[model samples]
Target: MTVPRAMKSTMFTLDGRRGVMLACMAPAAAFFFAFWLLPTARLITVPAEKGWSAYFEILTDSRYLESILNTVLLSLVVTIATLVIGAATGIYLARRSFRGRQTLLALLTLPLAFPGVIVGFFVILLGGRQGLVADFTHSLGLSRVTFAYGLTGLFLAYLYFSLPRAVASYTAAAEAIDVQLEEAARMLGASRWHITRDVWIPQLAPTTVACGAIVFATAMGAFGTAFTLASKVEVLPITIYNEFTNYANFATAAALSIALGLITGAVLFAARLLCGLSPAR
Candidate 1:
C-alpha cells in the first residue's frame, strides 16, 4: 500500500532536517577531533610511556611544585586585580555618557589587540633598567628601581592584557542590569553603599566570577610574556617549554602540561558551577 501524501511529506521533511543538522555539525566534530581530542589524548598518554609514576612526580619535584604554585598564585592575583579595576571602570563607562567616553573606552580596550610578547615589551618599556620608572627615579636623585624581569613585571603584564577582557565582560553585564532596581532602592532610602552592596554586586557576581576565571586561565597558560621577560621567572609554561626544548624531556613537559591543564580546568569548572548558582541568574 502507498503511504498517505501528508505522511510521506512529513517523513521527507524530517529526513531533510536531520541531514541539515548533521551537515552543520560536521565541521565542528571534525575540528574538535583534530585539534582538541587528538592533542589532549597525546598529552595525557605521552608521559605514561615513562610509567604512571611520572604523573605523581610533578607533586614530588620541588621545581615542578614551585612552578605550579607560582603560576597559580600569579594568576589568582592578576584575576583579582583585573576584576576590581575593570569592574569599576566598566561600570562607570556603562552607566555614564560624557565627552571622550567613546575615546576612553577605545583606549581602554586597545591593549586587547596586543599579544603577550608585546605586553611583555610594554612592561619593559615601563619598568626596565633604562625605562620610564628608572629615568624618573634617577632624575629625582633616588634609587632607580627596575622590576621588568621579576614577578612584579609578570603580574603587571598579565594585568595589562587581562583588564580589557574584564572590562568588556563587565560592560556587557552591567548594561544588562535593570536601572530601575537601583532607582527603586534609592527611593526606599537605601544608602549608595547599601544599594550597591545589596543590588549591584549581587547582580554582577556571576559575570565577575566568569571574567576572573578567563583571566586566571590566560595567565596560567601565558608563555610569551614569561619567555620575553626573564628565564628565571619559573612560571609553569616556561618550565614546560624548558623541559621540552632545553632538556628534550618530553615526558616531564607533557606531565606538567597536563597538570597545568587540570588545575586551570578545575578552577574554571568551579567558577562555572558558582555562576550557575548565582542569584543574578
Candidate 2:
C-alpha cells in the first residue's frame, strides 16, 4: 500500500508528539515511582510471615484505634474552620476594591511564607503561656488559660498554616466568578439572602471542597506544628514518628505509615469524587 506523503508526515508528527509528551512526563513519573511508590510498596508488601496480621493488629488495638479517631477528628475540624475563615476572607477580598486591600492580602499571606517550624514557634510564643492569649486570660483573673501541647493548641496551629492556603485556593475560585451574576439575581428581585444561598454558595461549593481537602492534607502530614503544640497528642503523624524514632520499630512505623497513607488517600479520593460530582456551573 502506497501512502500519501502528507498522511505519512501526519503520522510521523503524531508519533513525535507522543514521544515528546512521554519525555516531558518521564521525570515526574520516575520520581513518583521511585520515591512514593517504592516506599509505599515497602511499607505494604513486606515480611509475608507477619502478613496482614500487622495491619489487623494496629487497626484492632485500642491505642492505635484511638489515634486514628483523634487524627480524623482534628483533620476534619481544622479543615472546616479553615474553609469558613478562608472562604469569608476570599469572598470579601474578591467582592471589594479598596485602599490597603493589597497590604491586607499580603499580610494574610505572610504565614504561607513562614516555615512550619517558625510558624509553630510563633504560635507557641503567641498563644502559649506568657503569650498574648495567656496574658489576656491572666489579666481577666481567669486561672491560667493554657493552649499548649493539646488538641486545642494543635487546632490553632493548624489554622495558622491552613488559613493562608485556603484563602489562596478560594480566592482564585472567587475571582474566576463574575459579580454580574449577583447583580443579575438582584435585578430578578432576588434578595441578598436568596442570592447568597442560591448563587454564591453553589458556585463556591467545589472550590470550598478543594480548600478543605488541602487543609485536611496539611493537617494530616504536619509534624513541626503538631510536635510543638501537641506532642502528647497521639495523632497518626506523631504516632508514626514515635514508632520510628522513639520506639525504633520500623515495621510498626511502616505499618502506621501505610495505614495513615491509606486513610488520607481514601478521604482525598472521596473529596475529589465529590468535587467531580458537583453540577457544572
Candidate 3:
C-alpha cells in the first residue's frame, strides 16, 4: 500500500500540526491540574472523611451560623454601597474634565495601594477608643466614641478597599458607553433621571453585576481586615481561620473553605446569568 508523495506529505503535516497543538496546550493543562483540580478534589473529599455531618456543622453550629449571617450581611451592604458610590463617581469622572481630575482620580484609587490589614489600622486610627474620633467627641463634651472593633469599623475598612476596584471598573465601563444613546434619549424628551434610568443604568448593568460580585466576594473572604478589627465581630473567613489554625480541624476547615467558595461562586454565577452573560464567564 504505497501512498503518493503528496498524500504522505499531507498526512505527515497534519500529524505534526496536531502534535504542536497538544504541546502548546501542555503547560495550561499541567497548571490547572496542579493548582485547581488537585486542591478542589482535596477540599471536596476531606470533609467526607469525617462523614456528611461535617457539612451539617456549618448550618447546625451557632458560631458558624452567626459568622455566615454576618459575612453575607456585610458583603451585601458593602456591594450595594460600592456600586452606588462607584457608579456615580465613575460616571462623573468619565464624563467631565476639570482641573486636577487626574489627581482626584489618583487619590480615589490611593486606598488600593494599602492591604486589608493596613486599611483596618487606618480605620482604628480614625475610630478607635483612643483615636481622633474619640478625642474629638471627648473635646465636644460627649461620651468617648469607639467603633474600631465593631461592625462599623469592619464596614468602613471593607468599603475602603472595595471602593477603588469598583470605581476603576465602573469608570472604564462608563467610558465605554455610547454617548449617542444619551443624546437620542434627550432628543426624545427624556429627563436627566429618565436618561440615567433608561440609558446609563441599562448599559452599566453588566458592570454593576460584575463589580457587585467582586465586592461581595472580597468582603466575604477578607481575612486581614477582619482579624485586625474583630474583637467581637465574626465573619466566615475568621471562622475558617479558627478551624484551621486554632482548633487544628483540617476537615472542618476544608468544609468551610469549600462552603465559602461555593457561596461566592454561586453569587458570581447568578449575577452573570442575570446580566445575560454566559454562566462560564
The 0-to-1 C-alpha lDDT of every candidate, in the order given, reads: 0.92, 0.84, 0.91
Q: Write the per-residue lDDT of candidate 3 for residues 1-281, one digit (tens) a residue.
A: 89999999999999999999999999999999999999999889999998988889888999888988999999999899988899889989999999999899999999998989999999999999888999999999999999999888999999999999888888899889999989999999999999989888788888888889989999999999999998878888898999999999988889889889999999989987887862322
Number of clashing residue pairs in every model? Answer: 0, 0, 0
The C-alpha stretches of model 2 lying farther than 4 A from their native spots are: 47-49, 133-144
Q: Write the per-residue lDDT of candidate 2 for residues 189-209, one digit (tens) a residue.
A: 999899999889999999887
Off by over 4 Å in 1: 139-143
lDDT for position 47 in model 1 = 97
* Candidate scoring better on lDDT of 1 and 3: 1
Candidate 2 lDDT (Cα, whole model)? 0.84
Scanning candidate 3 in windows of ten residues, the lowest lDDT window is 272-281
Best by lDDT: 1
Provide the TM-score for each candidate, comma-separated: 0.94, 0.89, 0.90
lDDT of 1 by residue, 1-281 (tens): 99999999999999999999999999999999999999999998999998977788888999899889999999999999999999999999999989998898889999999989999999999999899999999999999989999899999999998999988889888999999999999999999999999999999999888998999999999988999886556899999999999999999999999999999999999999999888735
Clashing pairs in 1: none
lDDT of 3: 0.91
Question: Which ranking of candidates, highest lDDT first?
Answer: 1, 3, 2
Q: Model 1 — which ten-residue stretch has the worst lDDT?
A: 224-233
